[model samples]
Target: MTESDAATASLRPTDAIVLTGLRVRAHHGVFDFERENGQDFVVDVTAHLDLSPSAVSDDLSRTVHYGELAVEVADAVRRDPVDLIETVAERVAAVVLAHEPVHSVEVTVHKPDAPIEVPFDDVAVRILRGRS
Candidate 1:
């Protein structure tokens, strides 16, 4: 799909599997000190898919396995460090979309301990991705 199409695509109006507040330690930042010290990155993911088959048949295969997804997301975050949380969020979205059952995925990567001189609650990057 074109970039515009992907950007405009709406998430499927179906049951969603949501995982939140997943914390991982990684060295990702634009500054040397920030990357060297490392920091906790919080992730939130939402996968949209049909749950009727899984709900009716009680089959784990019919739906996304969140347990496995979380582990995979953690591993993705721990991969080679990048300078931006946008990249991190994209990595997570890629991992979630890799699951066949997931029609669309929403990923939010939160950098709570960001090296901002100003006092702020938090800094995060959120993205939505879907199959073409």
Candidate 2:
């Protein structure tokens, strides 16, 4: 199959297209030191929906506005200090699900600068939500 054919084939009415590793700085952690000394956070978002409208119309309006969604996630992460990445992920997923077009949402919050004694890349939490 050609590239265009593959692209089309990959899309489905219920398929989810994921945006990963979206880095944002936010104060999230259980330690008091972490909340006080804010650190960089990374987030991944997956939006599940029907892609047929955007696929056919080739119009931005027919699809979930990823740019707007990114901003919303960032804003939610920064709004109030959280003590855990789990809480951040849960909140972000809730916010994304509020968008009507999104049938389901998955959010992952990563904290690279977690206050662990051993060296580590990061710690993260993942949460999933779906419309009823």
Candidate 3:
């Protein structure tokens, strides 16, 4: 199947997972100053899976454990300080895909206090990852 077809097939209504507003402090940026002085980072994640097992078993182990996923993202960001938010977003996506039963993942990383010279609420990077 084509990539688009695979992506469309993964978006099953019954299989929905979301991890929102995950706050972490990480040093990530192009500038040296930004790297030295870490800043708050926010991440939002969505995972798609087959929820039938979880429904039948009524067990948390049958589905994705979002709390563990959140910790993994935080650990990755803290351990691997990159030079750009794009890299951070990609790394987070990779970590999520490494988990079992995750057919597709979407990650959004937000930098609330960016070093931009202009005024803005926040800067963010969003990426979608799926099984190939």
Can you give the TM-score per candidate against the true fold?
Answer: 0.91, 0.83, 0.89
Candidate 3, residue 75: CA error in Å?
Answer: 0.7
- Kindly list the per-residue Cα lDDT of model 1 for residues 30-130, writing each as its tens digit: 99987898999999998988889999999998888889999999999998999999999999998998988788888999999998899999899998888
Q: Each candidate: what lDDT?
A: 0.90, 0.80, 0.84
Considering TM-score, which of the candidate structures 1 and 2 is the better prediction for this target? 1
Best candidate per TM-score, number?
Answer: 1
Q: Per-residue lDDT for 56-96 in model 3, tens only?
A: 99999988887888899888778768888888888888888
Model 1 spans > 4 angstroms off: 1-10
Tens-digit lDDT track for model 2 on 52-83? 88889998788878888888888988879877
The pairs that clash in candidate 1 are none
Q: Between 2 and 3, whose lDDT is larger? A: 3
Ranking by TM-score: 1, 3, 2
* Clashing residue pairs, backbone N/CA/C < 3 A, model 2: 29-83
> Model 3: which residue pairs collide?
none
Candidate 2: Cα lDDT at 46: 90
TM-score, candidate number 2: 0.83
Candidate 3, TM-score vs. the true structure? 0.89
